[model samples]
Target: MRLRYLLLTLGIVVLGLLSRKTSICSIDFVRMYVGDVLWAMMVYFGCRLLFVSLKKSASFGVALSFSYLIEVSQLYHAPWIDSIRATTLGGLVLGFGFLWSDIACYTVGVTLGFWVDSLPGWGRK
Candidate 1:
């Protein structure tokens, strides 16, 4: 179960990165928005990977709360935080600006994550 989540997270992160580099006319919207969605799911799965004992609801709650907190943090622009957001790595981890759309993306991502997690796993050993 843990391995499955880890692999899914890795795959999503790769696709998200690729989405930024590749310009597909049909998926332009996905390229723009999917990253946010994948990021939210990555956070959820990463949390689950660490706290393997966490119940599904608790994991979802933590993921949603953490993602929301990151989104909310964008509203602040202190010099220190701003400096961090300026760097590439920092910018990726902590986004530069706030968008209401991002909240919706997070919701969608977390909901999908929950559904995936609930699936019966043939991969489980």
Candidate 2:
């Protein structure tokens, strides 16, 4: 079960990275939004991996909070944090700016996570 969540998280990370490539996705809207969606999905799966005993709702709550927090954190632009955001990994994880659409994407992603987590064989412990 833990392995499943870990693999799902990693797979989502790959997809999120691929979403940024114009050649791979082709669609402008998809390229713009899919990364944020997959980012939230990865967060949910990561939460599930770390808190294996948590109920689906609890896991969703944690993931949603974390995703939103990260998004909100973009509003703060201190030199130290900006320098971190200048790095490749930091740019990917922290992002450059805040978008209202990203919040919607996150909601969809976390809700999708909840739906997936409720599936019988897919989510069963």
Candidate 3:
């Protein structure tokens, strides 16, 4: 189960990276929104991987809260944090700006994660 989540998180990361490429996802809307959606999904899977015993509801809540926190953190700008955001990883994890749409995307992603987790057989130990 942990391995499944690890692979799913890695796959989502790759897809999120690919979503940034114009050649792969030419639509500006998709390029912008899909990455955020995938980011949330990755967060959900990461929670599952780290906390295998967490209930689906708890996992969803934690993932959603963490995603929102990361998005909200973007509103703060300081040289120390900005320098961190300047790096490739920091840019990806912290993001550059806030968007209400990203919040909506996160809701969708976390909801989808919950739905996926609820599927039969997937929940069994």
Top-scoring candidate (TM-score): 3
For residues 6-80, could you state the per-residue lDDT of candidate 3 as single tens digits? Answer: 998999999999999998888999897988898999999999999888888999999999999999999999999
Cα lDDT tens digits, model 2, 1-125, are 88899899999999999999988889998898888888999999999999978888899999999989999999999999999999999999999899889889999999998888788888844
Q: Which candidate's lDDT is highest?
A: 3
- Each prediction's total of clashing residue pairs, residues at least 3 apart in sequence or on different chains, is 0, 0, 0
* Global local distance difference test of model 3: 0.91
Pairs in steric clash, model 3: none
RMSD per model, one decimal: 2.3, 1.1, 1.1
Candidate 3's displacement at residue 68, Å, is 0.4
TM-score for each predicted model, relative to the true structure: 0.89, 0.95, 0.96
lDDT per residue (tens digit) for residues 3-67 in model 1? 87789889888876776766443577877798899898888888788888888889899999999
What ordering of candidates by lDDT runs from best to worst? 3, 2, 1
Q: Which stretches of candidate 2 lie over 4 Å from their true place?
A: none
Stronger candidate by lDDT (1 vs 3): 3
